[model samples]
Target: MAGESEYTYVVDFDGTITANDLSLELAAYYGGTGYREIENKYRRREIPIKEWLRQMVALLPPDLDQLNRKALEWVSIRAGFNDFLDQVREQKSTVVVASDGFGFYIEPILKAYGLLEKIEFVYRNETVTDSDGQLKVINPHAHKICPVCGNCKAAHVVRIKETGKSVIYTGDGSNDRFGASWSDQICARDRLAEVCDEYELSYSPWEDFYDIIKIEKPDLKDCSDISLCLPQGQGIKDGI
Candidate 1:
């Protein structure tokens, strides 16, 4: 029942939209020597992203303004991202940004590049200072039952799909596999591509957003078999 032009591009922030992973960079800059240990744990899959955020936040200073300032200075938008946004707007398609990182600087970074308004939605977690004056990560968009991602990108993909819009997921991290698995098409790079390969999922490798613009908008397919989560049914994968 959806129009031919009804398509949603579910994009990842951090390394996907920006040239570097701001979250990782920030954590490394402020988290100091201990940052490497936490990061290694995450890379080894010993801890999910939600747990990573909790542990990482503990190392960051409680001054959000200082963190935001650093993020603005270090943020760099990926090549062709602005053009891709223009093309999507011209085609009447939607762009939704999904990030499972620290997430406080996403808006500031996008607005700095004058691309915030181009996106239809941003699904991300919040970094807040608790009553005890410590920085903490709050996952308002997380899956209630799944402890994997701080912000459940898979749920965002399924929500758009249920509205009859075809979704094209784009990302560059290992955590992106969950959302990419639910998408009609996957545009992956870096760790995301590696994970897709590991899972035997079909995906297009991309270096920049220009490559994304050239990717054919895919027709909606039955993704139940390949998806890690059944949004309408039993929720996340059995062991995940």
Candidate 2:
């Protein structure tokens, strides 16, 4: 018999994990008008994310303390993440938080909520302040298309597929468009639903992620956390 294919849940941070858009929130909170213009360029793909961010950072006033502090203050993670993850563990499922965003923000945010260690992350790097008082985004590049992401959602989706497992993806913004395209099953909200509609893909709309726990290990609805009971166990997390 074939072994069970591991179930991987790939999630995006910024808009998806957090209830608020951290990038724009940080940009506008500290960067003001300059941030808005660069944001437009990001949406239009007029400039690469690195370049767009470079220009945005240049405009930030030279107040190291202010930028560092404000970076995390305005961002808001979803209300039920802790509960959602608890349920994932209850179901004994593996979870990966993937993004094109920096860890400086991601790491701290997770730490704030005591979730950094519960999952592994694949993402870009943290920010640094150059001696000249300019900001630098220090991170390795992503896949050709992923680099352009507001959060590199698609690259992680591809990585999960390469593992030869069944994947479930979730998100709530245009950032999710590329990632959702490759998912075996998708749960979406806001613009992500719009993206799925345009692409003719099937997706479920979710208001909060506790709904995700209910659907874990898809073949085992209403079963205990370990739903591998032989009756519901056929195919289970194992792929076709």
Q: Please list the Cα RMSD from the true structure of every candidate, rounded to 1 decimal place.
A: 1.5, 9.2
What TM-score fits each model? 0.96, 0.76
RMSD of 1: 1.5
Candidate 1 ranges with C-alpha deviation above 4 Å: 1-3
Model 2 residue runs over 4 Å out of place are 1-5, 44-51, 61-65, 144-147, 150-152, 216-240
Screening candidate 2 with a backbone cut-off below 3 angstroms (N, C-alpha, C), the clashing residue pairs are 5-238, 100-151
Query: Each model's number of backbone clashes?
Result: 0, 2
Worst lDDT 10-window in candidate 1: 231-240
Which lDDT tens digits does candidate 2 get at residues 110-210? 88778877775646555677888667666553443323443444545555666765667888865565666666678888887886786666788887777
Give Cα distance to truth, residue 72, candidate 1, Å: 0.6
Window of ten residues with lowest summed lDDT in model 2: 227-236
lDDT score at residue 86, model 1, on the 0-100 scale = 98
lDDT of each structure? 0.91, 0.63
